[model samples]
Target chain A: MKILAVDDEPLVLRLLDATLNGLGYHNTSFATTAAQALHLLESSKSPYSCILLDIRMPGMDGIELCQQIRRMPAYKTTPIIMLTSLAEKEYIDESFASGATDYMNKPVDATELAARLRVARLIQNEYQRSAHLEELNRAQIEGFQPMAPFDFAEPVQIDDVSRVVNSRAMENYLRQLDRLGLFKIGVIGFQIRHAGSLHAANAPEEFYGILADVAESISENTREVNALIAYLGKGSFAAVVPRASQIDRRDLEAGIAATLYEFELADLVDSTSDIKVSVGTQINGSVFGNTPDKMIDLAVRSAQGMTESKPKALAARIWSLAG
Target chain B: MINSQETAASHLAAALAEIRARFINDLIPLINEMEYQRVAMTDPALAPEAFSSLQHASHKISGMAGSVGFPELGDHAARLDVTFTKLLRAPYDHAGVQAALDPLEAFLSLMEDILDEVL
Candidate 1:
């Protein structure tokens, strides 16, 4: 795969070059500055399949560079991995907010870099396959059964919403926080009350549009607390917020309902006029024994009202027995 | 065929060793430049720019040193970078600058020792 790596330090670039070459990635280009990187990206004959960016640079740091690349139409869904040494929360938050697909801390381990690149390659291949399927569908080929590119339960990326990230990126953010021992986050799940009915009633595209609308409403409602929202498919969404932020469940539900109501009135939603979302109780990550997947699962169950009493009662019983 | 694979692996190892050696050689002058900035940081008039330059160098070293087989140097550089960043946020003072100098000097000495051994 064609790759581009941008860093101001030539030694780091050389090291990366050697490492990447050792990993059998030879069609790689290097740039010492963001401007130069942009030039290389634009002037190249074919778009680079994967991009590696450094967070700190003299002009236009990696976060800003990632944002700029995302604005380009060709790279909207391309894999952009941030390779940085800065482990500050602010940088990590900004990197994902700017549309980075993955992040890796530097001192470039060959094994880890290879793994990240493998994931990037997989993402790129999937994009290509979807694009091909989309083209075939658009062409209206004879006797063709149009297939839905994504499953109803797959976490589809909701684009064009501020502070909204893909599910994978959200998980990675949480994992990074966990690694840093700074995982003081609250996970909340939101589920559309009638998502299944809506999905069955409308066309796939229409259902997707409704999902995007719900995602936008969730994003707008949680904008005040700086929540990172992701649509974890089947009409469910998850939001990660700083645990210290006070989130009243009633207010959030009301706010989202009001926004969806406004969208229905404006004809922005076709069949989602009766749709309501259930807001889950915030699940705070404990100082110990809380993984990202477990927190997310608990939040989703809470939204679904599956674990309202059983788990809590069971935990209480266990604690009493231990006592 | 196995011989070819072994040859390729050996070639990669040699290339990586060369790059690591070159990185150490290049780091010496950069560390010297950081020392110059560290000294310049004591001057009130030059303190802001000096601090900025020093932090930039330390950040680079912290990011790159470990990849080139100097993990301890990278840790020291990271500590120095954090110290400079914290000092930059507060008001500029000689006491803060003086306190930062010990780590900077220690980092410089560490780099020197590593270079002496590596070279």
Candidate 2:
């Protein structure tokens, strides 16, 4: 990839140029001043793939140079990586806001720089590939079935663990499904008595804690299962687990219910009523097959039925098929 | 290097870009530990030791940054170090250090802006 390396320090500029040339990338240019860098870009007919800039420069600093480069039509979308030495948070935020593609610390490592450049290339490639695929998909979808805008009911599974719940006492249940070992499964919207209230109040801190405690209890009981669990907001949570799988639906539901029951929310329970939950599971899912964006959409949809807001008749239904 | 528009606006951006790289690598990892130190330092019994540790860290950062030509960051760090130092020297001025935190956070936010600009 073609790169324009800018740094006020001669030693740094030499090091960068040498590193890139040594790494088999020969198309490199060096500029000690921001004005010189701008002159080079303005004069060159060929566009650079990336710009390596240092913040401190003699006349026009790197930041001004970046802005000038961005304003010019030739280098608008070209990625710029800033090289800095200070480890202050304010500096990081400003760099990103100013339109830098990435930042690297001084005493720069050649390998890390190359890796970062490669990642940037991959992202750019993926973006181009996706844009092309999207056009194709738009046409293909028209041939298959009518498309509908996606909608979600609620978030599911605050904690990162699996559970089985069979207690008929609760209408909504939340549990995680991780049989495939590909992605995390989180089921949310389960409360024995106050599920509706918690859901309505937007799952207050007390309710969220109850949800986390429930997942923690299940994880502690099973000891065999481990996961990272956190509430996703509302009466829901997301649990990242080892895998996803299809299992005995009732057993899975009951295990979740059992784990939830161990949590002591005496105050919340007393203030309202018993808390119960309904569980949902994904029948056929693989992390590798489904991208994170698609998987999250599916998981959120899978947990929909566990909400009381669904038509009473629909809320009472169970998954006949493992889907 | 202080042009009203370029340095005030873009120069700061450049300066921030320089610090951004370090923030991601060094500061983020220490966040959890900083919180721990804050808790320990704010405690009634261990306040002195906590204040001293904070002062030491801030002072070291202030000195190091000053040597490297980041007078703005160095000045802020020195102010913070002094505020903490006050707490150590005079127990009654415990609240003095809290006011310095905003500037630090603001500095952090400035760095974040640079990152957004570049990345």
Candidate 3:
């Protein structure tokens, strides 16, 4: 695969070239500045398969270079990886905004770089294949008989409107959803327990306050949530947390449930009544693979399982489903 | 089928209207209050009135701006508020007031640009 390695440092350039070549990768090109990199990219006879760029450099940085590459028609679809010494949150965000496909820290390990490159190639190939299939699909549709309108019978499940309208805490919940959705780990479901009792209670304001606090606290700790943490009517709340590849599904489920229990949310509310929390988790093998929507559905099922179990100080149930 | 151009234009218009309404109703009032305090502070005889008004005006503007996600504006207003508060709390400094006002004006322009984007 043809790779363009751009860095201002000579040592970094030499190391990357040697490392990639040692790993049996051929056709590597080098550029010291953003201008040189762009010049070579625009003029190079051979199309580069992937580009690795350093973030900090003289006369236009990697982010600007990546933006420039994206603007060019030839390299619009090319995968670009930002190599940087600092993996700060702002840099990571800027890298993504500038259209970087992947990011790596400077002084990158050869093995990890090779693995990332392989993944990048795979992702690019998959995207190209999908684009080709889409074109074929359109062609076939044009040639064949007109199909019926897509089925509208399936009712669209609107997640609890409160989550969206509750802007005060929505950012935290939304961030969790984004993280989980990206990972495509599992399904998530939410139930709002004690709603009726809380509303009917003498101190309704205090009860709601407790509920909001608990939701905010849970949202803070949990990431990789596939589904909305909906306020299931009657004061129950739930969400599905995606488990990373290295994570043990059973342990992850238990750990999250335990964390929720440990959160001193009840203290936030001036409540005289005892606080009870119940959670249900399922190992969604099928939904765990990928696809954000499917993963969310699986998480919802797991959350559904929690409501069925008897309520305790902190009740949690586990359900296993085939992937 | 709805045309994407039409959809985008409609959404943009709706966003713009909402932004205009917010700026007029919410943001402008706060700015006027700040201006009032600025005027009041010009006379040393009304120093107490000016100090209280400035404190109220700047704090409210700063807080509101921050809540609505125009934090840079909020920060500028906040810095100005701090300078005003310092002037009142300890000793008065005209140079600090001037320094703070310059940035506040810059931030006001920034707020206008941000409103355009949101709209």
Poorly placed runs, candidate 1 (over 4 Å): A131-150, A265-272, A306-323, B93-95
Q: Give the winner by TM-score.
A: 1
lDDT of 1 by residue, A1-323 (tens): 99999999888898888789878898999999999999998999898999999988987999999999987766777798899888887888889888988888888899999999998998888768775434433433343444354566767667678988888778877887787787678999988866778778876667777888888999988988888888887888899988988898756766676677668722222332566677899999888777999888888878887322232343343344336
TM-score of 2: 0.34
| lDDT (10s digit) by residue, model 3, range A1-323 | 88999987654565566567655576899999999998999899977888999876767988889888876755655678776553344565456546666776544466778877886687558435654333433433365423222112211111112221121112223333353343333434444345455556524335544455545534543433423343333444444433442434343433344444455543212334434343445434342453444444554455545542232322333222111
Quality class of the docking in candidate 1, CAPRI style: medium
Docking class of 2: incorrect
Task: Decide which is better by TM-score, 1 or 3.
Answer: 1
Higher-scoring candidate on DockQ, 2 or 3:
2
Q: Could you report the DockQ of all the candidates, in the order they appear?
A: 0.63, 0.03, 0.01
Q: Where is model 1 chain A poorest over a 10-residue stretch in terms of lDDT?
A: A306-315
Candidate 3 segments whose C-alpha is farther than 4 A from its true place: A131-323, B1-119
Interface RMSD of each: 1.4, 12.2, 21.5
lDDT of 2 by residue, B20-113 (tens): 4444344343334444556676565887787776665555445334333445655666666657766788864446656645654665554344
Order the candidates by DockQ, highest first: 1, 2, 3
Q: Model 2: per-residue lDDT, tens digit, A1-323?
A: 78899987654565565556545567989998988898899888887878889875657877777777866655544677877553343444344434555666555566877876885566445434544333323434344333221112222223223332111101111111222132344322222334456545542335445655665553443334333333333444333333443334344445554445445433222334434444445423355465443444454456555543232222223222223
Q: What TM-score would each prediction reach against the true structure?
A: 0.87, 0.34, 0.36
